[model samples]
Target chain A: MEYRKIKDEDEDGAGAGADIEGLRGKAFSSSAVSNMPPVERSKWKRKTIVTLALTVLTSSQAVLIVWSKRAGKYEYSVTTANFLVETLKCALSLAALARIWKNEGVTDDNRLSTTLDEVSVYPIPAALYLVKNLLQYYIFAYVDAPGYQILKNLNIISTGVLYRIILKKKLSEVQWAAFILLCAGCTTAQLNSRSDHVLQTPFQGWMMAIVMALLSGFAGVYTEAIIKKRPSRNINVQNFWLYVFGMAFNAVAIIIQDFDAVMNKGFFHGYSLITVLMILNHALSGIAVSMVMKYADNIVKVYSTSVAMLLTAVASVFLFGFHLSLAFFLGATVVSVSVYLHSVGKLQR
Target chain B: MEYRKIKDEDEDGAGAGADIEGLRGKAFSSSAVSNMPPVERSKWKRKTIVTLALTVLTSSQAVLIVWSKRAGKYEYSVTTANFLVETLKCALSLAALARIWKNEGVTDDNRLSTTLDEVSVYPIPAALYLVKNLLQYYIFAYVDAPGYQILKNLNIISTGVLYRIILKKKLSEVQWAAFILLCAGCTTAQLNSRSDHVLQTPFQGWMMAIVMALLSGFAGVYTEAIIKKRPSRNINVQNFWLYVFGMAFNAVAIIIQDFDAVMNKGFFHGYSLITVLMILNHALSGIAVSMVMKYADNIVKVYSTSVAMLLTAVASVFLFGFHLSLAFFLGATVVSVSVYLHSVGKLQR
Candidate 1:
């Protein structure tokens, strides 16, 4: 499925370029009637709404997932379950689309037919997604949430590289600089001045985090390229196929992990309400992340996630009775500046 | 969005009839090439694959969710988290669609424009989804997994009623009989011959289960109506709006439940790796349920779920040392018969 989308990209790139130009021209013409102010305002408004939604959803996902695990004190390995959950998430998207089609009386048989035809195009990305999620679960085993937050920023750089190579989209020098500043900001913001806690984290965890970051970068870029390949296709239609493959991939993962145990004992032996809630949180965050990727770029996703981490830290001060250090404030400032620069760079480009 | 779909159904019924007729003619003309053999064989093959997939995914979801809760031993209320999870599911669907658009070079500018224009349509269904999910969490709290599974069969009847009234779709007499048999089978199968377990469940749990069934029925029918109304719209585009509203609705639910603790303490506390796994499980189930709904209908979804419950029961015999009563086998026989009858009826129709 992934290969098909990439192939589609190669075949369709010229058409897409022409379409983008046409869209730009349309935007220019529309400026005469609407002027830039209202349109820009609405565009910004939409972006803000999307960004904030992503931030809140993702942060909540991280927090709730961690908290649920703590509350459950479960001893089971999470990798297989994670794969299963990823698969389920895809199924849910497909279901949602079906529901929409049934209720809305919108008949585009062509689109539906095309969607099914394209089902063969999603397996690669879905497999990549499964691997990335599995690695993420492993990373949680080693790194504290705060450390994980900081290390994940490495994806921004990886995404930049992937973006250039895969999409052949050039980043301006300023944009490149912004990427560096974004990384620096995230590192500063998540810096733990507390020596004891810092030393407690295993070196293996850090290594895992870096690898996870690299994986995330590749996955994010790959997903973006797939979406870009068929920019005009119904997003939901494409998602349906992507998720179909994802579910299949995860099923294999679960079966391979321990077929006998999963089949005989059941996949959810020691689960609780908290565990269910945690799964829910992860699913939501997945959606939020995908949305950010769709409307913006991987860089924007990274920035929004960073902002979420910042919010989480501030939130911790009151919720957990943690005291903020001076270094924390300094990091927050630098990160904020970097975010502003990145946004400005995006606008200028 | 729900209302729009419903309205569209009313408006487009004639057009749909014509389209169906047109399609039938096409099918008739194509029949000369191979008669029924190849076509029938392929159709049956597809159906078998889909049904098997649905059964496996749904069953795993049920077992894992129940097991996760049991393992956690946590006593916290799941209402707020349920809302958050529900919201997140929608967001995830949206994100998936967006990612697809980004990857696939399909650019329908009008589709994007129309998607935004239709944003106001999703809140009603989104809210309905929220309510149904919340009720489900409560049902889980009161009812044990096995009991929850059996009682949920009530939705089969409710769905039939709702389908007739909302979607104006009629069930064959055989289909209705199948529904009745399905309910009876589920009850008989779950009936505890063991006195100790039999007396333990509260009446309130039964009542909650009933309500959850009704809600499920309504939500399922309503969603089907919405989707049927807009068969032509991009499922992902529509999903994006639906999720946007769903997130908003969940945000309200979270705030109304307890604004201060959620906001100050943040949503995640006492979380661990296991909790994350459990969340992943729920998300996967959600997807599976959706997929079943999309590919088949509510009847198929109910049947698949029932099969999952039976699998879970059998698994418990091996994993949890539970004994399967003779009555369970008898009930299973009846349910299987009903499923076969329903499938035949659908084919005849």
Candidate 2:
């Protein structure tokens, strides 16, 4: 990620001499608002928009997913539903790529990346994510929902470790501190009210959660790195490849776990309005994850999910009669601080 | 505080010109280990020592105070003990100032200030401290200890605000985030297990806590500003004046709260080894606070006291069989991160 940033600075140095003449021409007309050039301001504004959009979309997706799961158990097979979500996400990415290609002309990496090596890389994360998602369902049998919510925060820590190891990114000491606080805050936010909680997590459940977190973190950081490897590549192209592989992996899972059920009742067995919404939510969230990985990083994705967790907890207070605990309040406060420290601290000179 | 640092840099520039000859002489002898000058390394080492010492001392004082009151009441009169602690602290400061004077000779600020204006400034914080300390006793009557513990964290936020307002210090957005996280973490760490919590804080208690927090914050920041106001002032001399005023104010409080008790019995009525030890601890902690405020700022004092809160809680778990809750663990993690970010993140650039 920083490598690409450095390249931009190099390009800026080369471009500044040529742009000087145009800058002088515009100075007369735009002198009143001259602190930052309009182009730079617009770029910053666009980045902010993207980050905010992703945060809102991801947070709403969390609420929707919980609402859909309000029925104690899913009426549909998890395997088939996951496959459909992947398929829809794949289609969305292709549609996006098609629009961009038409407007900007074809690019080498954006149009499915013609290189064999690049094509092979997408399957790695797809397989990891597939295993992680599958494990998510099995782990629920061993650990209760609240316990799992707390365990899920392990991903924040894992993501930071993998980002450092795989991306060779050197986070400042302060950023690492921010990352730890984010993880702790998210975990604290997930704490169930005393009366609602049970301390019955099995040893196996702990092991499974660790595995799931590692898989999720690795897949996320790997996806981010590959998309950013070719910074000029269209994000839709990367998302398309990722979802295509994701569909293939989920298809394999379905064949193993739900083949007979799907064959007997069709793919939309136990379908409902809520189920369709769930599929749509998952698909859009998948697309948002890819866009965030491409434009932002694993850190931003972690921050969004953490804030999302807090928002979900807040929604639960009103919608599901969840008690608003002091733990949750303090946790939310810490998370807010972590977000501010991360975005501004690292950037402050 | 920053003004003093700027002056030091200016001195370094002039000294460096004269020191170049000495640097060349040392270059030959210290060429093997020359990344940093030994003098610079020693200065950094001394700073680390001071910070660590203050942290340990403050944390120990918290634990000891709690332990001394394990029987649930102070047998000794609060007013007289506070007065005695203040007297001891003043004597300690005077002794320190005398030692410095004997060694390096008396400087204007290193001894009692000849300026009446400077002597007059000390009583403001002393009076504020007096009210805050006296309120500490009254607050317990309204709020449970745990609830009061949570409310006490408001001082961290208030101190940050006053530090900025009084010192004209512009904290980066990240530092503000760190302060918030520190406040939240301390509050979380103080969360009593559900079985132990009363959740019965009255409106009056809440109001009193807020007022106490503001008073404590203002007194601390005001003291820091004055101590750092004359950057060359001997810390011991400044501490001496503050403590003398503090002793005088506590004497007034003693006259009101303990005059009858003292007249009937003695000034040391109901005293024990624990009470005497507690007074000594309070005195040393007071002196340490002033040293920290002068060398550091209200922020450092807040951090020290916060970490001290966590340490005291951890000690309670082992010593008093306090049940260790997940809330405490998560809170400690957040506090640790806030410390790291406040120390390293803002300094990273």
Candidate 3:
């Protein structure tokens, strides 16, 4: 991570062909990266595969949870799902492997000192993101869907303001306007009546979504921090470490809360369909996190996330025979605009 | 834009800071750029302003349509919104003016032959995007929110494959894995629910979403083409020109088909807010396009778009009161991961 700052600035700064090449070569040549004993590489690879397996496993558990809830099996599904969830425990072992592997990369102990100094010291933001995701799920457990959606709008403002403060990023005029419009879109969606009932009584869900937004903001801030600390590190490495830590934390909590349930559930759920899907989903998440960490800025990562949601919003209406009022569409569009503007604002700044 | 190929490849390589500066200065001082008369500068500025206005005006009109549909005060809100959207247009114009007003230093503009001729030209991909957006909105008008949300996952696949074929950009293992996982996530979402209620006549909505996805893909390709053609233009200029062309096209379409519907509906439906928001979105889009085009690559823009969608998805769940089953949460997470990977993949390529 530690390197001399090459101060030359072109209009199209960095990421030119040469820069990308230089980075790759530097990583490959460093004794820190190169002297990885085969044992470490194998261990690292194994952990990545296990994490991928957990992702796929989760998909089936999700299906079971939904189907079981419909069949008056909430408690049963929770218990059953917990068993399926145990597959994620493998992620912990993977985490151990990663820590060991990363340690192995430290051949030049002196270099570690320099790298440490070069990297952002703040782990608070990353911690906040982990907390945020956990709370988001917690709220999801309690709150109805529409309510969760609306509260999410707060991120439009929260992240915008946070990026400004933490990343020292500036906002453009259009970005501010976009942010306001996004909020307005949320207001309009609130008025649409479709999501009204779902959001009403579950105050806890509402709180969680709010917390998630804030956490997401913090995650965003920390993501930038990590990227800035080691501009040349493979983003996959950054992402893997984050997941390794976050998943391990989550697995620990699950085990502590329901040790018996974790031990009892089947390794693979009924029909095998749901289990397969869960594993795939987990794998996807792993891949996406790694990629985002590698190439784009955190804000850009956020922007892509927004667009994907918009696409899903549009699709949900037709695929599920669910009602999508003009209000929903309008709100979604506004949110899209806001997200788009946020990115533009970054550029303008 | 073209310049003589660097005959001395060694000096032209990295570390040739002085060469870059000389080129920058030389390019700025070229008669092709600086020799323009005052009349030409004013003319170019006017055209740029007009182009900016056109994009803002058209996009505002589109947003106003959604707002009016929601507000039921179409005639009033449309106009107010239009006015609101125009504010951004004005800001962009002002920015351009400020840049020119502040242009006191040596400016070079040597007319150099461009090397775009060396690359293969493909217009089919570009034309495809135009048709895609129209189809997306058309589907949107009919589909339920949730249905549309699920189907949009196709975009990651679409963009990646297209890039592979058209740009010959290699995909990484993480990217391939992410795409597979994203597709799996979509499949899981579709499976988790009962399939009893397919849209008997889904042609209108489903087709539209499909088309929109296609168009978005095309737009992605078209932008890449522009970038490939002029590898050296400033990102701002490239983005500005893209918007200029896109806005011009959109504006003309509006003028020809539903100028009365757009303007009259906007005015009667609260024209000020709708107009202002639309203009703002357009201006932001323009600036974003320019920045991505100049500083980053088109894929960077793609990554941003994806991140924005991710944010929207998570936010929409609560905002719209959509049911957030385990599957939805997991799927969204997967989507987020896919976005990050895609961004990083592009960077690697």
Candidate 4:
């Protein structure tokens, strides 16, 4: 996902008469975007479809995780086993990509030079992701699925600020307003007046959510820099090193917190059909994000993720019978509108 | 008060490097502004100072009104008396402006016009304002002072929308985003989780606030059109007709709503030092608005009025012991920032 293509859409996309739906012709069809190769239309379509898939996978993961649990608690060492599954999934993706490159006779330095020097750069973001993923699970203890979905949008603010600081990306005034609106929306959503306990996200949940957003934002910007620093490197090769470090970090996490529990209960103690599906959803969503980035831009990813939030909320309402408060609904509406406005700003840039 | 001077300030005032503090020549001083006469520096300074004074006067009115009342109720009809006071104030202002014209030895048709044709246009806005002002008095029956002050910001949205509809003034995407944020902020402010009854605006209050905002927006935009349609017309001459019609409408309101009550208890039943001061504040604020408009722009008025909202809230806390909820504070903060963003958009335009 870090190795993404970025192309300027029509200014009309900024509501400046931008053909937001098509956004072709003189607007962005010209091959003038810095650092971006001319995009093939089919590739763009494929990436968009993949992003749509990512949306479904991401939205379903939380609901599925909740469904997999019994009495609102997970039977497994939720912390220990997910990393092992993710490790296997990453290895599989790398194997597939390697085979494809070999068939194409791509034995260049970028492909073969996956030395320790290059692999060494992956650990920091991997470590950040490790903490972030762990928090994702822990956060469930404090908030319901719908509430968690709303809180997840707080990541956008941290990501936007970090993107500006680390990448020196200039966001327009509209873009800044959009970011503020998104933050305010997420805050407003949290302020939902739910007298019931089932849908409320507590103060502890908010703290954990903020930490998670920060860690993820740092990891994301850092990873993006690494990917863009040497765009010639095969994305699969980079993912290989990143996954290796991620697995190593997750293994360390398992050792520190869930080691004894996993040892006694066995690695597959709480494994069930739904748990397997959730793990699959998680792994596939990760792959889908990378696939989308191979063609589409960050704005697409942002839009899809925001849509996923509303999808998760609606799903949670139906599947878990969660209550959607008026404030949450209005706040989410604002968040969605702000996301659109932010994308418009993205096109302007 | 409707008559005023108009000039473009520095684009920096829009927060766009617009010398928000001293936007001067080579910026707005180049005298290229369409329909605007070149301004003297001293005149601009005087107008801005008057604007500041207007802010102070506007903020104090609500506080003074609450102080003037006994047990949160007014002995006289609030609806009937304000218009009478406003009429007298407008008349005084018109008289002063007439003297200024006489001193300048100016008696052009633009300065002397008081025809039925000219005066007729004034009644429409006066009527709209009459209805709006009546609602202002009735709304207190539904909401408290602090909440009402927050809700008053709903006017921004209506004003923005109507400005576009009536004036065909193009708002940039950022300005549109800012407007949305302003609305979101106002709504969020209303959602404050104040346990006490004194700081909350109920559902009916929301409805009334919206209506007030719409009425004021229409009246404002329409009045601006009338004022700008003939740039050379002396503003004082125009204001005289507006005042005359406003007084007429205010009298009609008295007849329809409080004929028996006023006839029996007399118009001065609720008279107090504070009441007189409140009327003075209201009248002076109106004059100050026109005075500021002569040299400044709508953005300056907006900034002053929003600041006045905060001033009102703070003052309410000390004088009436109003509770300032966390949500209200956060919401007002967002609204303030959005106002700045919107002003920046204005500068861009």
Candidate 5:
């Protein structure tokens, strides 16, 4: 039964590229309406600029972070960069929200019937992710960093299993083999690390990190599954808006707490600037994501963006003049290759 | 055009359950054999027992780890349980390799196609997954534990964006809202932490964790996309065989490594034991995944299994006597709720 599925899929794979391209052309036809109202056309034009600006800005920042890390500047620089990037992320997310807000209730050109309803609407996946993050933060406060990192890698393995089980997707020999390699690489990196001995107290941070990774996988897988069930919507834009919404929630929560301390904090002392930037960044990312979804496949988009994320991470290590270990480099390389291969596979077939 | 696709999909979605189920049943009946050779039948029975045993043991071990962590005994105890679980994982993986070796080319009882060569071959995704794992291990060695954990959660957000871009799937409003909820939870978790204001050095571990999570998403999305294109050959055991193949590679690698250190490394040390367990874990997981694919939808399976993973993770934290901050707890709760809601939605119309 399964064997036949694979054969059919392979046969289809050859022609799929063309099919997808055709789908894209048709998908965008509605959006490409001629003689649109000036207001709508202007909105579209502005959005186009916003999207271009974000892609360029993000791409540049990603590159700069990578370069700076290699240059090895001040000790605080990495942290600063992280903060800046995160702030930028927040802003991009907000921008995405703005785009969504502008076109709220606009139905998708292709909408599918879903099981979603007001009563059944729930936020478990997202909530679980947050819980996982909070747990990690608490754990980090108590544990060693490297220990946590090792555990974090388990997410891939876990997700690989989950993907097969949940998605009912058949993995090729290469896909299966690659995941093993990834696990092997992670183990190797850990074994080579200095702290192989028992910990006085297990690093809470490390535990949290692992939990976070797992939660992330869960959320991601669920999102993918659910998204597939719906009609093709403005995914990129929606993602950004979601971020914006999340940020707004965070900001509001912060406001109810030690607002003064945060306002007078060292890095983001100016609320107005950070707030505005955060919104803009989030919104822009949404648009960019939407554009990517509109044009490419999920694997391709993810793989490409992950490369950017990976570079950003590597830059953090060197740019901040942080101490580097051999195992760390090995692990990073392993991860980079895995992401690249996965993305490439998606693109090819 | 987009609208029509949505309509088509909706029509398909509503009737697909029956269509697919009916198709599967028909395929099964056509391929169903009345006179199985005694040799093959016996072999299958044995294989099923072995698979079941391995799954039960590993799952129990996983559960045990959670329970021990919740009980807050010596950290070593939990580690030991985890180690056993890891060994089981290794053994399971190896066992899978054995299965593939023994069963390769013997397509029987329900393959979509009888020949593996009929499918398009691709190794890029597998290689990419391998790289992802290596990177994860590298980062894990350097970062604090909790920090690593939180970073991993970023998988959810990344997966959402990637799915939209790569799969051209649409996300519903609720799922989109859930994404926002997750981000908020993570941000709150970050803010709620009482860690030092200034970093002494860059958190390499945390970065690595995030990198691993991102890689997993990339690999996972690609795997799903590819598998969707290639239907499974029916034997309901392709995933099993794939794992078997993957395990073969892993076992060879493990055996080639110097066993002296691993075998004599104090408690739970034994290269042979580790090797065995790893094979078993991988093998069962692979086959089990195929079973899931055969019986259920992708998102539903993922969503359900994720619940189990999260519950186990949370259980581990409490069992281990890890500290739980209020805000962190709240965030985690929200994330869990969001995921739950999403999963529940899948079960609906």
Candidate 6:
């Protein structure tokens, strides 16, 4: 749900004067935030922070997966990791909700009833999340980190399309053009040099990446639509249910994959502490993605992912001793230009 | 900041009619939420869901950790895990911010300026978080999972005291009593039988747990005070800075611990996939804790933690083959009563 709607409804429902007076005593204590005009503190700062967080976290996850594959010590199935990640994320979201309840004191009895009533709507998005997560692992297997990074940019275009169709949110012509440029820039940046035929990626990997982009795009847009539909609801609360269903879906997948392997080996079989860190990174990235979707939109998420890909490439240079090609710099420059154009276009609108 | 204030200010700043018309088109399209009064949605449902989620996740983390310790494969130092967890969490928070930006379209030039303006205020809380997280590892080392669960309840009292002293918010008599009962119930629930003293716990563990509680109490309450001080600020934005400082602190700590070893062994030294999951679980739980503190009061967080402890205990029975004590049942009953009493007290107030 949009943050503004929740704030507006709270004022209307509680009576603005009384609410303000109450908040003034509690919120306007001796702190830097108390003296500022409310308008100056824009919600965009929060969204940007979340998006950046997601990018960094997800990039780390990507790096870890690539590193693990290179190490060849990680023998767990992708589905197993996905299951673990989903379960962990679901639990984490719930914990976040509890903290929110304790600190904000915003939720009351009536809200609880409505949340129960709305339980039916969560399964769809949760299912989509499960599918997307599973696809992500598969995609990782098919392509190298840099290749996956570039190809995944397809989500930007797909997300734009989905935003228009599912959320019925029209994109400006400039926005559409920017998306195309983003895709082209990402592809160019990750393209292998013709002389270096050392690492040829399979065609199936490219196909899987494209399908992943599509699934993620639709899922992201659909989630946004659901959340926006109830602007007055707590985003974290809705997220808790979304993760719950996601966990359920993953649980079934894990069972189908092999209950004995999971049971006998335990969740950490053949896993070292580094693997745990990667999973944690993955889980946090998941939370970050949802936060972005809830607060901003799929387009912003795509940009963040693009930025993350660049960061990942840079990190690989230092960590893996990988060389960056000239094409990469050219791609980076194009992506920067496109991002600038999109921002300017948005401002004008 | 509290979510409600942002909405009220937006209405006043942008003009109510234009904003509502704009929202109506985007938020009201064929969704179930359009027909209902915003007030009916309430916040409790979200709070309850989050709390439940936290309980499940935290419990699982506890169980996994205990299992790992028993497995003897977790050779990596707790400090290493702590460092990785902090960094990962920081990145995740940023990613979440990015997603928020994509969805909300709230950031503009002015908002960017204000966000930059507010950067200086985050370091204190961020440092506090680093301290608290490090202290948690120390606490975990000293105490068993169940013992840690019981003694950690002390934070409820400390949090209440800090909330009053720092935030200048008064607590009702019933709320105070509920807190007392909560601590008592948690203590009693996890009390071990003298005859079954198979695991000899040291007095140092208890001391460390109490110290950890005090730090957490102060950190939780102070963070709340800062957040409340600016009701119009975005929580995710604030979280970003807090995490940034935390990451910085952890970096310094890692260097101090032994830079060469970390670099040589790599951060994943002796770690398996399970270790990665544990770290992921820990990071998410940390986010959950902060979220609880941000959205609700520390008291509710205490309650949520207590519930999580119970869930952990229950899970241990199945997974770890631990027997549930009669005292555990009694403690659960008492906790339930206190929860009911607290809810009723809140309603009356």
lDDT against the true structure, per candidate, is 0.53, 0.66, 0.43, 0.60, 0.40, 0.58
Best by TM-score: 2
Candidate 3 vs 5: which has more DockQ:
3
lDDT of candidate 5 over B168-201, digit per residue (tens) = 7766544454454444344333322322211332
Which of candidates 3 and 5 is the stronger one according to TM-score? 3
- Candidate 1 is graded, for docking, as incorrect
lDDT of 3 by residue, B113-220 (tens): 224452233233323533543354456456544455455545645665766776776766545644554443443333234321233337766566555655565556
Per-residue error (Å), model 3, residue B314: 5.2
Which one is best on DockQ? 2
Deviating ranges (above 4 Å) for candidate 6:
A1-37, A106-117, A132-151, A193-212, B1-349
Q: Per-residue error at B106 for model 6, in Å? A: 68
Candidate 4 residues B1-349, lDDT tens each?
A: 0000000010001101122223323344446333344465555556547666766766676466556553443555654555755586677766877688767766664465566776667778778877776676688789765566456556767877887898687778667876676666655665644323433457787789888888877876777667666667777766666667767777887787678988998877765666566566666666665555444544455555655666677888888888765456556756765666665555655
Model 5 docking tier (incorrect/acceptable/medium/high): incorrect
**What would the per-residue lDDT of candidate 5 be over residues A29-142, giving only the tens digit for each residue?**
545434568886664554334333434434434444334334442222112222343345556645555566567744452122223451132244435544554455466455
The TM-score measured for candidate 4 stands at 0.75
Note the chain A TM-score of all models in turn: 0.73, 0.82, 0.58, 0.75, 0.52, 0.76
In model 1, state the lDDT of residue A132. 60
Fnat (0 to 1) per candidate: 0.00, 0.69, 0.00, 0.11, 0.00, 0.00
Model 2, B1-349: lDDT tens digits are: 1111101110100000111112222444354235667886554444444555656665565555666667544666777877787788888888887788889898776767658987889899878866776676788778765566567677788888988998888776656777788788767766655512434577888789889888878887888888888888888888788878777887898787679998998988777777777677667666666666655566666776676667667777788787667777888887776665564444443
Worst 10 residues of 1 chain A by lDDT: A9-18
**Given candidate 2, what's the lDDT at residue B138?**
83
Q: Residue B230's C-alpha lDDT in candidate 3?
A: 58
Q: Can you give the lDDT of residue A184 in candidate 4?
A: 64
Q: What's the ranking of the predictions by lDDT, best on top?
A: 2, 4, 6, 1, 3, 5
- Say which candidate scores most in lDDT: 2
Estimate, for each residue in A190-296, the C-alpha lDDT of model 2 and write its tens digit. Answer: 66555124345678888898888888789888888888988887778777787788778878988977799999988878877777776776676667667666666
Question: Which pairs clash in model 4?
Answer: A12-A17, A12-A18, A13-A18, B3-B235, B5-B294, B11-B18, B12-B17, B12-B18, B12-B19, B13-B18
